[model samples]
Target: MTSLPEDSPPQMSEDDRDTAVQRLQEAYAEGLISHEEFDERLHQVLTAEARSELVSALASLPEKHPGTTSTIGAAGGRIQRHGVWRVPRFLKVESAFGRVRLDLSRAIIEHPVIDIELQLGTGRAEITVPRDAVVDVEGLRTGWKDLRYNAPRRSGPGEPKIQISGTMGFGRLKIRHARR
Candidate 1:
């Protein structure tokens, strides 16, 4: 494999380089960068060709997302919710500065066959479900603290079980599921 040039951006510190790469990947996945832009910038970073390009890309990313300022409820913080509860799929909730609390206390249960999945990252996450909701959780990984679960006993015959798998860093995770 070819190597980076000697004068490429002073050889960024390992930690700084890793953080930049992670941010770039997250921005690409969140649609902040187009496929072509992502590919070109990733190539530049990997080959150490245009370090300034990476900086420019990172600077331009936040401008595209336009942070919102709405409060979710008694949560007393900014909570942005996306996706609908229709089918079994993935739900990703992320934050950098504040905690994320998912209060499913008011969710309407029309069908007794719904499955919920969650992915938490970089912040505290609290998920609350009702006593009769059937949930299967997966990929639950946390950092800085152990994952905690709290919920009332299940009212129905079937227990709401959680199948967790994933990793969290520098934060705590609390999953509240009703037990049968």
Candidate 2:
């Protein structure tokens, strides 16, 4: 079998693409990229239909911040993340027969974006963000789960975005914005 051409598109997972986009945002936030460059790169990243395109778009970006996976599990108890705390890149939060609250109003977001894999059962997951923070929820394949209120969020460069995904069983996930 002949190998694909050098210009051929590579295989990039959604997570990877998303991470690349986040890096671009971080670069823009750090003043490394001007608004024009940031807008152009972001458009390329978002409109890229192939993995090679994405790789090309990210080639000019700086090295991304190392991401760490953290787990916050609860059972018959309450888990809360509030005040000024360091938010990791990826968080695996599990709540079974308990409640979970993650408040990012005053949290220190080290990365441009954070991904939370929320697993809930017979419990509730409440995520509160500042009025300017952006919240995105996706990839929930829950049966009999009660997911209420997904408010639309529009994020920009230098803004914090939280991408929450996972499964919930007979539980509830509430994402609300704090009142000023």
Candidate 3:
């Protein structure tokens, strides 16, 4: 077996580091730092091990901007949101005899708390999120109640608080992690 450093966190993506470097370059070009300072910061950004480390390295940069309300619908079809995307504050989902997949593992969540109103009628719905997110589904008005809960849902800092509400009928609503 192999052992890693006790202080070392999870490895971050190279693209994340590259983006940090680009931000540093932009800041330097904007005269935010001198050449010598930029070089030093660039070294630190390139060597960051964890995502948190890289985020701290670029804390001075602007955060991801918020998105407006978005409504995604599917009628006898499929609707999916995966990869990198801007999650709006309010999301209205409609699916009738269709499939709806909302993957938020790598999504840019602008608001800490998100409101989702689902109108699923005789359709399947799947919500994929990061492992740390909290999902609430008690507001769903459905008679078909076959539930599976892997972990308890709670809200806190750095945790996406998603509130699910509205009408659901003759369909399955599954909430799970992206890794699973």
Q: Quote the positional error of residue 26 for candidate 2 in Å.
A: 14
- Give each model's whole-structure lDDT: 0.50, 0.75, 0.72
State how far residue 25 of model 3 sits from its true place (Å): 42
The worst-scoring run of ten residues by lDDT in candidate 3 lies at 1-10
- Comparison by lDDT, 1 against 3, better one: 3
lDDT of 1 by residue, 25-45 (tens): 656645567889878766666
The residue-by-residue lDDT of candidate 3 on 34-125, one tens digit each, is 89978877888877777777766666654333454589987778989999998887799988878888988899987666767888887778
The digit string of per-residue lDDT tens for model 2 on 1-180 reads 112234544675676568667668656755678999989988988887777777777676656445577898877799999999988878898877788899888888887767788888877788887667777776565658666765755545667777778888877788887765
Question: Which rank order by lDDT, best down to worst?
Answer: 2, 3, 1
Which pairs clash inside model 2? none
Residue-level lDDT for 169 in candidate 1: 73
* Global fold similarity of model 3 (TM-score): 0.57
Relative to the true structure, candidate 2 reaches a TM of: 0.60
lDDT of 1: 0.50
Superposition error at 167 for model 3 (Å): 1.7
Spell out the clash pairs found in candidate 3: none
